[model samples]
Target: MATSTASYTQNQSILDALSRCIAACEMCADACLHEENVKMMVPCIRLDRDCADICRLTAAFIARGSDHAKHVLKECIEICRKCADECGKHEHEHCQQCAAACRACVEACQQYAGQA
Candidate 1:
């Protein structure tokens, strides 16, 4: 059975989406680490991990309504964008899915992060 997410205040959908994206990215990174051509995916996996961590933190910050969420979200967007771009270079299915997730999260983070 799938676990359901509880309701959160302010930007709940975006936060939930980001959390999912982060998890997918993390899983993809781990899978890439175990691939035969791990060396070729090292950098992409590294950034994927980094982006996942940042997205997780950003989601928590937003959920908690922290004052620093904006700053963190700004950084998270940058990381997500970079990671997505890197992941797109790979031909693996995991990488492709992770790239899509990261892009969605990036857009959400940027929208809620601060002024346009």
Candidate 2:
């Protein structure tokens, strides 16, 4: 049975991964907005937005221990991969941080996103 939000507590690994990914997305978005050539960061900006939203959704799914958690984690993995790839192309501190976070999330998802 699925757990309710009030009773939910993600396993340490899952919670840590989600938190890192969430922070990465937010940092990436803020970085893109602060780019000296903001126009050049358009793609990264869009990806950052998507990454942030998906991470949040994934976290919620895990927190509730819902059946959809695996599905959401799978999606989060794909989004993190994409975001990490994009962030790796940039030379900014935030982009670097984002890349690390995305990688961490990918590893986390692999452990928990089973049989989905």
Q: Least accurate stretch of 10 residues (summed lDDT) in model 1?
A: 1-10
Off by over 4 Å in 1: 1-10, 114-116
* lDDT (tens digit, per residue) of candidate 1 on 1-116: 12223334337877877887888898898889889989999898889889988988987887777899888888898998899899899889999999999999887776665431
True-structure RMSD for candidate 1 = 5.6
Highest-TM-score candidate: 1
- Cα lDDT, model 2, residue 95: 92
Relative to the true structure, how large is the alpha-carbon lDDT of every model? 0.83, 0.82
lDDT of 2 at 96: 89
Checking candidate 1 for backbone clashes, the offending pairs are none
What's the alpha carbon RMSD for model 2?
A: 3.8
Residue-wise lDDT of candidate 2 within 22-97, one digit each (tens)? 8888878987897789999998888888988998898887776688887777888999999999998999989989
Evaluated against the true structure, the overall lDDT of model 2 is 0.82
lDDT of 2 at 104: 87
